[model samples]
Structure formats: C-alpha cells, structure tokens
Target chain A: MYVESTGIQVIETIEELQKTLNRNERKDTTVGFVPTMGFLHEGHLSLVSHAKEQNDIVVMSIFVNPAQFGPGEDFESYPRDREKDLRLASEAGVDIVFIPSVEEMYPADGGIRILPGRQADELCGASRPGHFDGVLKVVLKLFNIVDPDRSYFGMKDAQQLAIIETFVRDFNLRTAIVRVPIVREEDGLAKSSRNVNLTAIERSEAPAIYQALQSGVEMFADGANPEAVERQVAEGIIANSSGKIDYVKILAYPELGPVTDDTEEIILACAVKFSSTRLIDNIIMSTKDGTPCSE
Target chain B: MYVESTGIQVIETIEELQKTLNRNERKDTTVGFVPTMGFLHEGHLSLVSHAKEQNDIVVMSIFVNPAQFGPGEDFESYPRDREKDLRLASEAGVDIVFIPSVEEMYPADGGIRILPGRQADELCGASRPGHFDGVLKVVLKLFNIVDPDRSYFGMKDAQQLAIIETFVRDFNLRTAIVRVPIVREEDGLAKSSRNVNLTAIERSEAPAIYQALQSGVEMFADGANPEAVERQVAEGIIANSSGKIDYVKILAYPELGPVTDDTEEIILACAVKFSSTRLIDNIIMSTKDGTPCSE
Candidate 1:
C-alpha cells in the first residue's frame, strides 16, 4: 500500500520511532501525535487531521495495547487491519505511523503500571476495573517516546480523555494535550471500531446511545437537576433502544466527579451493548462559567 | 556564601525550570540531571560532578521527597540546609538547581504512582514497603520535568540505582542513567545526609558497615558461596558495630535477584539502624563477566 507522495514512514520498532522523531527534533520541527488502538475509523482520522494542522510533523501509533484489555475483554479478538490503516493514515497526512507489536510494548511479564489516584474510582472505572490506569501507563510511555509538542485525543471517549489529561497534569509531562470534538455518523451514532460487530438491527439501535446523551444534554441545558438528567438518559436508552443498556451517567465534565452547585460544563454520557458490541457516547454543556472553553 | 560570578539558576517551580530548559534545549545543549534529597554532602556532590562532566548543562534537584518515606520514617526530620546546598551546587558547576516544595511536586492530593514490578520486592523493600515504588514515582516525575540527556545516581543505594535503571529501560525514558561510585568519608564510612543525625558513638561505629561490605566483596572475589558471603557480612556488621543490622544481601548486580553461577557482577549491600537513624550502603564487585563494572 504505497502512498503516492505523502512521505508516510510506517515503522514497527521503538528504536526506529525514536530515530525518526529525533531527526525531526534536531531540525527544530514541532511534532504532533495521535495514538490509537487501530482499525481506523472517522473518529481517529479527525484527531489525525488536528495533529497534522498543529505541527510540522505528525506521528500516529497503532498498537492494540494488551494491558488495557482485561481477561475476557476481547483482547484475543480485537480487530486489526494494517493494510487499511496504512492507506488511511497516509491519506490523512500522518508523517509517521508507528505500528508496534504488543510484545514490543509489554514484555512477557507485564511491566510497571500506573496506580491512578482518586479520579479513576468513578463512572466507567466501576464497570471496568484497572481500565483507565492501564490506558494511562501506555499513554505515558508513548508521550515519553514520541516527545511530541502536541498530542490529539477525540472526546468520543470522554472518560479516557479526562483521565489522560489528569495524568499529564499530575506527571508534568511536556506534551500539550488537544481535545477534539467527537465525530459522528449522519444518523448520530458515534464512530467506533466495535460498531462492526453489531448486527444490522443492532447497528440501527446504536444511535439511541447518542440520542440518550443528547436528551440528557438538552435536559441539563434546561436547568434540570443532575439526578433528573441521569434518570432521563437511563430510561430513554432502556426504553427506546433494542440494545442492552450498560450505563447512563451525568457528571462534571473532565473531572467526572459529582455535579453540584459549583459545577460548570456537565458531561452526559451513556454506553449500550448492541449484539455484543459495546459503544459509548457523550455531550458536554456549560453550567456556569466555561473555565476551559477552548474546545 | 555565593560563588564570585557563577551563573547558577535556582528555580522553584516546574514551569520556570521547564522554560529555562527549553531555551537550552533549543540550542542543542545536552542536559545532565542529578536528583537528590537536600543537605548536600560529598555523595550527592559526586553525582553532580559526574553530571557536569558528561553534558553541556547540569541540573540538580534537592527535593526531600516525602513519598519515598514510609510512615514513622524520616520525612519530617530529613535534614535540609539550602544555603549550604546552593554554595556546594554552584561550586560543582551546576547550571540549575530546582528545589520544589512537596505541594508543588505532589499536588494537594498526591497523584498517580507507579506499581513497581518484581525487583521492588526484595532488599530495602522488605523493610519499607512501597519505598522503591515511591522513589520510582518521583524520579519518573523528575525525568519528565528535567528532560535531560543523561541522569546521574550514586551507587550508595545500589538497589535504588538498579530499580531506576530498570524503570528507564522499562518505560523507555530518553534519559541515560549514569551511576557514579559511592563517595566515602576519610574514615571509610559511606557519606549520607542521615549521618548527621547519628550520635558520636553511632558515627564512630558507622565505619564497620563499610568494613562488612569490603569483607563481602573480598569473599565474592574469591568465588565464595553467595549465602556464605551474606552470612559473613551480616555477622561482621553485628559483631563490630553497636548498630542493629537490618539486612546484608549479596545478589546479582542490577537485577537484584538471587545470585546464580552465571551471575556477572555482585552487589554486596547492607542497611543498619543506629539508634533512630537508618543508614544504607553497598559495593559492586566484578563477577565472572563483570556486567556492572562500568563504574
């Protein structure tokens, strides 16, 4: 899969990636990074676009990290297609695509992992124990290796983006984190690689996850209490969709803490399992002052 | 007592230090870092000299990290003399000295920490649980903020140095770890800030700790059984000193694992309690192949 003239360098080893990044670093070129667990979708491509526009060189890493996956969590069957990813990433203006095998990222024994503090105890963390901490460890590793001036993450995974942002602040890492808005299908379904696993009918029902989030966002914007917003979303997903509801939560934006009188910019989010495919979506709305309104 | 005209920059925050470093980084200057707990002594000064010799710029941080201290350990009473440290650091050719408050290094609530792998289970770890992991967390934080080309650590804490080197390799940090030889007092006691806390009798008896280490090194050089070597060192320290011995371990150099027939270099390490103060020291001697003889 040769890209005509994109100059996309697809390297598979950490040493080669460091050499590539170092060369750009020596020339005083600012590098931007987009990290992904592959199977390219529009959501990831949007982050790639943001990265390319922000820096002189853009690097995208495609590794289905094993640490983030639990024992029964589809690690063995996670979808991977390097040929398609290569062509799409090249066309998306990624200067370097780092595709490392899991063995390269983690040794036979799992290396050291992060014990994420209080922030990881709520919402999604309850359902998937050690998930976000696993994510933080790998992202921290990538940030150290890539040494990017800026790194992009799609807000499609609001919890993930929030946790990683906290990790950066807590560690005082040099890279700047840029949060991009989620990209959705015309039917309002958020783009996800897991969507491919859904049956046609289940896929049709997946839009309800976003619809529930949208409903909660509207209710919150109308000055409804957080409890009411959460109830409305939860009931809406369970009642209107054929998919099994996982969770519908309403909370403070990046902090993911409880919403109170002091809270501003609430995030209403939900997840649904449609024919064994679990998907999540969220919407952020202002409550009072927009402290971080850059997005 | 300031140096006549040495341009030593003492930064108190991560932001200011980063800004200072970025300017030098842009000029392609190689940065060497030495991280220390305050009350600068010959041991820490040795690390700083090695750092200065290896790079265009030398950065030393004097942070009496509270995390590395377990409850009942010396976090509150850790000796600190900033004025003396400043003069000594400036004399050592340090370009920058970063002294961050615990609040600045660790946010209001101490944030994410690393869960160190197997190597953290033995040695000092058995005496002070979660000690090396705490050291790892702070060092990882320092490496991120410093962004140095090479970092220096004294071999006095052989276990700590080994674990940090493993961390650098495991996480693929850009900084190269350079181990400096342990600096000893004229009486042959390993120099440590904790030495100041000892009573006159304890101070006088401290030389026996190093004497035991030297004895162990001599035994290993003669290819003595590692178990017999450990016994000799423990009994020597106990019989020769008024201090209560904590541990005497002769293990594979950097791995800190059990010694085997193929072991290349051996670390003869000990920790002893002199009244209320704890002192640690070690010596590395070449084995069959001498993998750790780089120093």
Candidate 2:
C-alpha cells in the first residue's frame, strides 16, 4: 500500500526538519503535525487521519520525551516498538516521520518548559507534577522544528490538549492546535500506547473506565446536578469490575476546572488502576442551554 | 524616519494574530522581535537597532504583561505611551508594531504559568513570587505572535534573558534568542524606561548601581573570591544608593544560577530601589578555569 518514496520522509535533526519545512512554509499548502512518543495507536492515527484530511502534508513526530515522566514514572518501561509504529504511520498516510533522538531534542544543558499556566496547575498537574510541563515543552519544540500550519492531538488527553491550546495562545505559536475526538477500544478503554502494557485481565476490566465516564455523562444528560454527576461517576468506578480508583471527576470540559452548578458543558473524566497500569477516559455532555458536552 | 504606518496592531484575540501572521508568514526573511512594555527608551531602541541589523523585518511588541508584575506593585501604574512608543519604534526602523491589550494576551479565565519547574522557581522566583510566570507567559505569546528568525533581548534583563534561553532549549524552539549588550547612560546608569519614574535624587544615585556592578566585575577579574565579590557589590550599592537592595547576586553567566568560589563565566547582578522605583543591572565576568562566577 506504500506509494513511491515521494510521499513520506524521515527526519532526525532540527536542521533537516527545518530545511524540509522551509520549502513549503512559503506556500499555501497547509501542514499538519501529530506529535507522539512513538508506540502509535488508533488514537494517534485518528489525529493523523484528521491531519491528512485537513492539510496537504502530515508530519508525525515520534520522540518519547523523558522530561514529562516523573522520577519513577514509566520513562524506561514506556512501551515502544518503532518498527510497528513506523509501519502504522506509513499506512495512515503520514507525510513525514520526524523521529529525533533524546540528544537531538535535548542537547547538553538544554532548558525550556512548554507548560501553560493555570490550566496545567489544575487536573493532571497534581498527579503527574511536571507532566504538562514536559508535554508543552516537547510540543513547543516540535512546533518550532516542524513549523506546521496545523497540529492535531487526541482529546483523550483532554488536559494536555487544553494546555497546548493555552500554550499556542500564550506563546503566539504559529501553528493551529487542532484536537480530534478520543479514539477508544471497542470496550471503551481510551486508546493509548500505554495500553500495550496492560495485562490481559487489566485490559478486560479497562472498559469499566468508559462505563464510569458514560454513567457520569448520562447523569449530566439527565439533568443531574454537577456535584451529583461527579459522585455518580466515582460510585460507578468504585463498583467497577477491576482496578483501584485513582480519581473520578466531573469537570468543565476544555478548561479542566471544577464543574459548578449545572454547567452547560461538563466532562465526566477519570483515572483508574488495574494493578500497576493507570488508564484515563472521559466523555463530554451538554445541557439544555446549548452548552457544549465538553466544556 | 517614518516608513510604515503604526497603529499599535491591537490584537485582542490570539486567533486574530494567527490569521494575520499566517497570511504573512514567509521564508528566507529573518524576523526579529523585541518584546517590551509600551514605554519606549534608548535601552529598547538599542535592542531594536540590533534586531534591525540581522532581520529583514522587525516586529516590536509593547505589552506590559500583568503576570510579571507583583501584587501591590505598579501593574496599573506601569508607564504606557503607545503614541510615543510607536513613533520611537517607527523611527528606529521597525517593520511591525504589535501592541496587544491584556485580554489579547490572556484568556479571561486561564491562569497557568507558561514556564514552570526548578528553573523558574529560582532567582526572581522567590522574590517576585509569580513574576517569572508572568514574564514567561507574556514572552511566549510574543514569540508565537512574532515567530521571528532571531529574537533580540537586552542583557539588562539578564535573568529574563536566561529564562527565555531555557524556554527555547526546553521547548526545542527554532527561534534564535540573541542577547544584546547592556546599554547604559553616559553617567553609567543602566538605561531603563523605569528610570524615567525615578526622583532626581534617585536618578543621581542610579549611577552607583552600575559602579557597584563594575566593582564586582573588577574584583572577579582580579581573582577575588566570588562570594566576597558579591558581598562587596551589594554593600557598595546599599551604602551609596538611595534604593533598598532587593538582591545583589553574582550568578553563573547565562545559567542565572548561584555562583560559588569555583564558578566561572559569572554575572554580577543586582536590583536596588530608589524611592518608589526599582532598577536592575548586571555585568558579565569570568572566573579562572572558565567556570561562571556562580557555580
């Protein structure tokens, strides 16, 4: 299914990426970028597919950033299979595979944080600590290196997506930050490269996360109070088939702030554990005032 | 003289700036950006002059970022004369003048600090509190808007320059951040728009700021102990200056970290008060064995 070599290119250095992009930068051809830490999945593909449809060129970056991972968080154990990822990206019609090494991304004495303000401090800020900082830092670096006209991201990482949105605005970034819907497994687990690490039993129980989020969505859809919606989502997760509940929150979508009263848009989101693996999922719902399902 | 029209391209929306820049984004043209508050000064002019030399187009952004200003500090009272700044920038051969209103830079709701972590949490971090957060937030927005080939900053704002340097590296930003040498008054007072607000007595005492920094540089050059050099510099300012000493530090040059005896490439920097105004400056120095003055 691969077209002749003109369709896709691979870049590992800032200079090469810039040289390639420099040619198209002057033209009206829209370039869309999808940045990933490799180990590609349908979720990333969903972004790629959307990017392919929107722009004339699609640039996918596969650099597993170490800065985003905490002290003991999955920096080493983070699943990676570049061969598989490369094939999947090629199949998805990606125009370029910008796979930079750790040294390429961060030279000795490299320092920068692409994190956004208030948005990062909330939600995942507490859990991952420097997670959003790392995400924004890398995304920004990618944006500069790729110089894309538009960049696509999966909404599964709603907080990360929100922070990027803020970063683009705050930094006056040149690229458009486009967000695609969260692609999920048939059973409702939000698709992630990390999903590959889940044990068979953990994978089976993964759908409970979607179920809990769906229950919250349903509650909000049925005119439940925002507080009550949060409670119901937590209760639903606690009653799940397997795993410990890390957090069950019904927040304002997009902003990731606490949901107050019966907001027009509420996001039913959660993080849960099946043994050592952690999974997160969410659903956006709206109210009668025509507020968005995902705020 | 007056070449291009200057209306303070008041972009209240990030989307608007994106739309405008997208239409104008070009390759091969070096875009030089100089970010500042509205008040114009020779110090800022010096930066613009440097930008004009290397760039085909120069974009000067006048934004008094509220985030950088401390509470009970003069965020509201910060000097702003758009007409004056436009005239000065236009006279200095600027191509574009970007003067975004507060709402243009920040969303009504988002409050996240753009650059966070240990780098941000040091130096001015402990003193101004959220000051660096504000500086970074605004600077990121400015960079995004300008998307310059090389951005120019004055060495007068050494820590700010350091943070921006770190920001570019961490995010993998392609924009080259260039620091211009510090411009000083003939009297040795560091050129700052804030210098205008100083009382006559404070103005007379301002030269001591530079003098003390020079002494620190001389001491370090003469192979004096770094700590002793820093102490002498601080003591000199406190003894002769009208302003209270905020911080008199000899930091490792470029890194903006603390200096030890073995530190090389050091910067003797300080901020002191004169009545209601605060003035800051630094002199770059190197220790033996090539370590920054601060280690």
Candidate 3:
C-alpha cells in the first residue's frame, strides 16, 4: 500500500484506508496510531517514533478537526503543511499517512456525539466549552477507522490526553492508549503547532508557562499543599510572562480530582494567553515519591 | 472456547469474551453479533439465527442496559429468565453468549455518553427524552466490545434500528448493520418480551397496533399522503383497541424527515399504551413504488 515515489502510503479516503488496514490486519500486523492536526512538529514526530517502535505498522492521521475548535478559535488560521508533514512522517517511520478531507471525514451531519463528564469542566475545557466533546468525537472516529492496536498521544496537551484515556477506558475500546513524554525546546518551552502563531515577544515569554509549572513541581516536592503550589505557580507566571494567566492549579493526575492526603499523583498545570495566542503546559508528578512523572 | 456440556460458550466478563473473540479473529473467523436485553422471544432468536447464517461464529450479548431505561420505566420489573435465555440461545445456534453484570459493564461513573440527533426526537424519543442517547451509549459500547464483522438488529423496533444505523454510519464504525425483518405471532402481533406483561385483554388487543400499521401501508399503496396515512393509522388503532395512542407518524425512512414528493422511502409507525404495557410497531414502505419495504 506504499506510494512508489515516497514509499509511504498516503490515504485520502476512509474506504481505501479500511481496505489497506483490513489486508494488513488479516496478516496479524499490529498498528500503532498517532492522530494530529497536520502541522508536524518534533512533538508529533516523537509520537510517531514511539508508535513505530511498539508496533509492526505505524498509522498517522492528519485531520484538522473543526469540531474541537470553538468560535473565535484558530480553526481557520490553523497551520497546515501537508508536504512537510508527509516528509517528516516518512522519516519518522509511519507506514500509512491518512490525510482525510473535512468532507471525507464528516460526509453527513454527526448526529451521534461523545460528551465528556466532569473531566472536561476545568483547564482548557473551561475557557473553550464543548472542546473535549469535539476531541472525543474525532478520536473515536479515527479509532474506529484505523482499528489500531495502540494509539499514541503526547502529554504536552495533558488534559486532552487525560480525557482521551478516560474515554477509551469507559467505552471499553480495544486500542491501548500509550502516553509519550512531551517534546520541548532547549529554552524549555514545550513544542507545539500553535507556537508559530506567537509573536517574538510572546515567544520569549511563552517559556514562562513551563517554568511556572516546574516551580509548582518544586513546591510540591517541598511538601507544599495544593493551594500553595497553585499560588506560587500563578505568581511566577505573572512575574515573568507578558501573557495573562488563564489558570494555574495542581490536582490529582488522570482523575483531575482535588488533591487529598490519599492522592499520590498530581498534575501542576497552567494556561496563559498572549495577545491572540493561548499556551498551556503541565508537569505530572508523584506526590508521595517527590519525583516528576512527566515533562 | 465452549462449555463442553451445553456446547455453547458462556462468557461473563469482558476479559474472557475478548480472549475468546481474539483467538477466533486471529484465525480469520468472521463474527456476527446479536445484542439483546435477555428475555428471549421468537424475535430475538430470529436475530440469532440470522447471525448464525451470516458468519463463521455467532455471538449473542444479553444484558438489560440500565442507561436506556428511564425512571419509573419498568427497569426494576424487567423480565429475566437466564436459564431459559441460555437454552434458547443455544437452540438458536449461538456459539458464544456474553452476559456481563451491570457492575462489569458500568464499573465507574460513565463520564462519556453518545448523544443522538434529530432522528431520535419524534418517535419513542419524544415520549422518553434522552432515550436514544442511552440506546446509542450502550450500543456503541457493545459494538466496541464485540468488534463484529456484522451486527444483526430486528426491524420490530424500527426507530431503534434506524438510529443504530445512523450511529454506525456517522461514526464510521466497521460493524455492518444487518436489518432483520420483524418476527410476528400467529395473530400478526409483533413478538416482544414485553408482551408477557400485558393483561389478557390487553394482549388480545395488542395485535391491533400491527394491524393499524398494515392499514397505513395499504393507504400508502393507494397513493395516500403522509398526513392521511398517519391519520388512518391513528384512527384504526383508536377504533380497534382500548388503548391510548402515543404517536402515529409517517416520516421519510432512516432520516426520519418529513415525507414529500421527493421522498422515496417512509416509515409508518405508531405506539399504543395499554394500562401498564406499551407497544410500538412500524412498517417501512417505499413511497415511490408503493410497497411495504419491511414489516
């Protein structure tokens, strides 16, 4: 199913993707999937690389899902580089690169939707209503289409990763969710597709988001309570970044519940808005062992 | 994966069911699934028989989905005869019978749900709000668990069939939806588990619901408009039974839209409540050629 020129299969239709995957599945080939919005960065390629190592075949889907974007969001202006993305995907060892059009993905009105529960109420979902619902919708569709053995998601979008994990577990889906470490730049800013939208000044200030999360992680390690850790993180972002703080808090890891004495894992997370760009970063830490669990 | 005595494998947990199916699936065995609430009547057995005919292995699931039942909607008093259901399933050629406990299916607060669209609004959904949402939720979970090549659904619950079809199509699910025609009693009453709940007099009168749908089919065959067909069906139900009419509708099939000159297929459907028992029956018809497409 490879394109002769690139040696990477580029599938544009669901029928063809299903046909190719069906043939591979019959041969007991395990598929690892990485879903993205078509702007391949180091973060996305890291997921692809992780996928390639774990399974016989790697499938990367590049769909700029409109459902996840709210009004006034950057859906229309969202960056896309198909040519560069394919080259990066091929280099990353993707066996199949699924590039479905909006029409190809959603040929009809999607009467059926996956609604998130309390897990979607805070963080990014707080600012953007119905955002997690849209994410779950597209992910479920792609899961059904690809039928991958394992699906890879980066922890950079920690909340999105958490919500997706909850969905797969609750739905009893066969695909195992694999969490990859977030890819970051040398200056310690998390790699993101939206980073291109940042102005030079905003770009310089953006690293503060991760720095604040690290500060929160240190406070938690020093036996700070959840409230203290939250306040320190918020103050750090205010002190260094031109971006307005959207939210800064520490909560139980995947559950996103209130941190209590029994809670072992916690997430130090924050979102900051710089002019027209919004940036989010988080550090998952083990509260009991005093160690950072994820970047 | 068979229970030696009965020659039918009965799986109680998701893990065991997945193990059995995975083994079979690796051998390229096609699975045909029939999902039921477990008080098996002729209609349900018919679905099992259809599944048996279509695939190398037939899997039947029997669990009364609590999500689909509303408050005060007979969830507690729902009929169950597991021994009899097992026997019927075995006799009907079911290879694997999955009977998961409520706790197994819903171990935690299901923070995710499948919300259905407008196709749910007019029929049973109008009376039972959020009913189709519950239906879609359970159906999607079952589909994920089974991963069948084809799933059999009886057309007796016409709207349920339509909504399931829409969910599969919109979600781009791999399971092919196989529509089995309605199974009826000698008296032409549609066979249902709930029929046993009806009083003797009510049971005698219940056949009128199907008869009314037949009358509506004749009207449509005589070139009756949608409104006229709806009226005739309602009048026939009122004239023949001591029951209250819930709704009688003639809508474009599958889409459940308004029937116009451009419309080719339509559903003539009705619901009648006889004291404690409520019954629904429908006839899918082709308006363009003037014929009943389904019982």
List lDDT for all candidates, in order.
0.82, 0.75, 0.87
The better-scoring model by TM-score among 1 and 2 is: 1
What are the per-residue Cα lDDT tens digits for candidate 2 across B1-295?
1234554344445555555555345645677888888688888898899898998878888888887888888788777887788788888887777776777666564555554455554456667877876787777767767667788888888778877787777666667998888777899888888887898888988898888878777777777776798799888888886678888776676666676655556777787877777788887766664333321
For model 3, name the residue pairs that clash: none
Q: Chain A: TM-score in each candidate? A: 0.93, 0.91, 0.97
Candidate with more favorable, higher DockQ: 1 or 3? 3
How far is A107's C-alpha from truth in model 1 (Å)?
Answer: 4.2
**RMSD to native, candidate 2:** 4.1
- Model 2 clashing-pair count: 30
Question: What stretches of model 3 exceed 4 Å from their correct place?
Answer: A1-4, A23-26, B1-4, B23-25
Error of 2 at A185 (Å): 3.7
Q: Is model 3 an incorrect, acceptable, medium or high docking prediction?
A: medium
Model 1 complex DockQ against the native: 0.55
- For every candidate, what is the interface RMSD in angstroms? 2.8, 3.5, 2.1
| Number of the top lDDT candidate | 3
**Which pairs of residues have clashing backbones in candidate 1?**
A265-A287
